[model samples]
Target: MSIFSKIKQTLHLMKDIDLDALGKLSQKVDLSEIMKTVGELDDRQLAGLMKMLKHKGGKKGQHKLPPIDGDFYDMALKLSPQQRELQIKVRNFMEDEIKPIANEYWNKAEFPFQIIPKMAELNICGLTYKGYGTPDENYVMEGIIAMELARVDVSISTFFGVHSGLAMGSIYICGSEEQKQEWLPKMAKMELIGAFGLTEPEVGSAVAGGLGTTCRQEGDEWVLNGQKKWIGNATFADVTIIWARDEASDQVKGFLVRKGNPGFVAEKIENKMALRTVQNALITMTDCRVPESDRLQKCDSFKDTAKVLRMTRAGVAWQAVGCARGAYEAALKYTKKREQFGKPIASYQLVQNHLVEMVANLTAMQTLCFRLSELQDEGLLTDEHASLAKVFCSMRTRDVVSQAREVMGGNGILLQYDVARFVADAEAIYSYEGTKEINTLIVGRAITGYSAFV
Candidate 1:
């Protein structure tokens, strides 16, 4: 190789070094003399110099970063011993059982059905629900559990939410005593898996005002006909809470549609980019006949369904905190270890800015969700409170995950690193339960004393 060629190659390599640090170094060192030495170097010597520049940028450095934690405010310290134990238990289950296979199963877009019984043993299902074989824990504990589940894997947390929060919650809040007796026990035991089906193919944000599914009271039954989309756990749930508008009353009602009740068909939704481990199903109910006894008698209108939503929406906010917490922690660890210019990238001011922003957003979300759950437990949680939490947390979670991905650079898109999945899953969380626009308007209506919902 020509001597001139080696110098050119060395100059190209110098571009990647931290320019600000390099400028400082130039003031302390004789760069012109260094170039004079470099121009005179033999080919082998130049090659060695280039290697040093590539790996260490011609400098040696060491750094010590504190242990990575997303809970900047130590929010967990407020938890009771039992609540903390429950949180650790869920976190261990996720890190031990789920984290190992999360990416692979997510790549295949399939649920790990084997974990269902194992998860059931936690006895955390329906934790906040009172009576009928429940731990009857507070809403704060339930929110913590949701956060722990999502911290490791968002999809599993989502599956649990659809069952424990939505389906069982429907039976708890809107079902008759007989209906609860028949479903809640087996469901609490995880013997009867459940799904909540309210979203329709053509309606989402407008579902409250315009549910496409309809049902009519027959002689001894109700015949339901419509399609529901993006229903989590619908494929294998033992029973589904199907909400449909009644033809006569024109109000929404809930029914326990058993898996194979004549015409209920659930096809797996494919090619999803987010929450792939969840078995979301596109349901087609063609004159699906459900017995009158299976109906949720207390579900008199969409207002009743709103009750279920208001309860679970707070939980969704907690899940958003988990998602953001996971992403921020991952990025923090990566930045601490990932090196540039012979030092951890986290040492750089700009990179620290990104990490700080992520944790700031995460901490804000955690404190907000804490209060949101407290309100829920105190029976002071209103639709606007839940909606505000959902809005702020879900929106901020996106920002945190985006920064998590950005700090990782190209590797952020690869699922092997886990941040990629968080990034993708955050998108789903942002859109589900309620979108930002819809939830914002809910809060707007409450404060302004006027409905802005279109």
Candidate 2:
């Protein structure tokens, strides 16, 4: 109503306007003409204009940003609509089903058997294999599924990887047509859970050259002897792919050892600090008899074993990405909500520095794995390529989870915070599949002409 009141109100509204933006707008519109037009407005019209400007161009704009996603490069946008749906489907399943009970089962050192049926419903097992009831998706989709599962629970991801990638993969890659038809379809349907037995007590990284488990062929049967350590899902897996050295040939051979074999025993390895929910077993085979038909016909040597590892190793790299992503996201969300010195800890320069480093490493790992999957789909992926990704992603994931713990302070060690679990799981991931030293040597041998593994 009054000119003075309108002038004062305009000044107050101007305080909220972004002056730089207004200056840019001035280049398009004549400021003097705009002022002349505004001068004629009554108090009500002035108030309405102020509200509109504040809503649109105020210092704190009215726009609400979507939540920060860990996939910083928007790689999911590259997925086909069908692949994208599957990715979201798996993510939601992990968040809704596994996340709630992750800590509980993890703390108790028990696998959640109830989830098997529900997880089977996802129909994601044997993801890359073309037949035997597989979905025939690309390797990228397979990697995304692995990342999604590990993002929520590394233990569950490991379980799935063992069954889907290693066990089913051995059959798909090395089994005879009859063997694949008999086993892969049921395993894909989750009717027959599978496990992989490769690592031995006396041999780990050096398993390629020194497999202690021995397989001796008899009449239409092979008798297996010696032990397998850290065999995931072995305790209850319907079938375990046992890799043993042929006593006659000295080359490695894989056998499909069914559960309930008279001489096969799987004792749960307990008291693990990492991946506690995974039921890793120390397996012993004493004269275990497997029929010749049960042997993976194509797997006559260690190179066949390496074939499976090369494929699964890439998935492990993606799992590392998920583990880091889960930790980084948890840390970022925690720092934002957590206050120190009367403001959010995330507002502090040092805290932001750590977050920036974590995100940078996370982004690098994601992009690298994406390209690695592309190579896989293109059939250009090699043992060294998978080894490089496994080494880099696993090593970086340790740093990311460590930073997550450091930012959380005292709460970092507490399992309830979620970051602690990732911190512990990172250790296991670093060692399993292949140690950093082993993987580094693989890359070393690839780039250089000489081998330094000895």
Candidate 3:
């Protein structure tokens, strides 16, 4: 018989079978011709076919598995309907737009500048900030957005955090009203991108005491001199918030250093194993003259700088949660698909044990961060609250991603598998914002009144 005739016959037989049953049977049956013939069926015939699909199983048409999502706690449901929609919008954007090209851009260590406008359309920059075109969302929404963004690509999240949380946050928290009015609006719109320069070549954890970078008052202008290392987004940032110790006052101050300023130079840091797409710059400032007005007006000391860090550090912890969730979800899906011996590897006890362990840690981290964001929204959050979460979540994420990589076996290390990127990115998350040792000490100080971060 012709292919159409064969398909018609098959559809006739399948008309009484459950759709799920038909699906499973179709996998084993040579139904190609039947499928072709069914394509030619009229609407009534198709409806009849669907009706037939309803009776092949017990009571239900077919037993299909639930969606294999990693949000085990249904945290997304906690968001407002609008917030949840925004979450899905970002998730769709990441899957459709970023995932396809993530490995390529990561391998080349190049930022995908083309997606900037697309990101701008999300209206997420300065997510929690008020005024100046910002969203004025709550801290939880901000954390959720950061988590969603990092779930697909940590580099993009880092780039955005530097711009919205660190750079603009510095202006928002420490800049004078005039400065905020001048900069926050343009930045909120992404018309101007920003960077934060704080860590120095010679000093990192010790930055608060004194940085090698120095700003000397020179009458109408301040001459900045020193180098900043690992300054994210600085390579092409329109404005960099350079933090340096004032030579006379011995206090750290913030300067709005414009791009292409004659005395400022930024070279991309290369060969980074983590967050390669972040465009970290080793910045050198030699007699860079910035106007006094450019000085962060309300920033009297390093205390002001710490205010911004305290705020963004919570978001970093949320990013760690995303990294863990992404890895765990990838590994779980891989286990279900990858076959070994006579059946799927997920059926193996050892593999299931690993999956359980990953989920346990991931769940704990998620719960911790959720509460942290809640405390922040309630205005009860402190540096120790954020530091504790950062230290714990980042540390736990390292373990989770490692197990995720382990579960994938050889494919775990392959970039195409997706878990490898999370593996590499976890290392950077562990070290940045605050190292485990440092953040732990901060929490230690808060709890026991002892400072060990000397």
Per-candidate TM equals 0.85, 0.86, 0.86
**Per-candidate alpha-carbon RMSD to the true structure:** 16.0, 11.7, 10.2
Clashes of each: 0, 0, 4
Candidate 2: residue 178 Cα off by (Å): 0.8
Question: Distance (Å) between predicted and true CA of 236, model 2?
Answer: 0.7
Q: What is the C-alpha lDDT of each candidate?
A: 0.89, 0.91, 0.88
Better of 1 and 2 by TM-score: 2
RMSD of 1: 16.0
Better of 1 and 2 by lDDT: 2
Clashes of 1: 0
Residues 1-454 of candidate 1: C-alpha lDDT, one tens digit per residue = 4546545556665755778987999999998888778888876586578556645623347433355667777676566545666777788899999999999999999889889888998998898988888789999999999999999899999999999999999999999998888899889989999999999889999988868999999999999999999999999999999999999999999999998788999999999999999999999999999999999999889999999999899899999999999988888888888998998898899998998888888888999999988988888999899999999999999999998999999989998889999989999999999899999999999999999866
Q: Mind sharing the TM-score for model 1?
A: 0.85
Per-residue lDDT of 351 in model 3: 94
lDDT of 3: 0.88
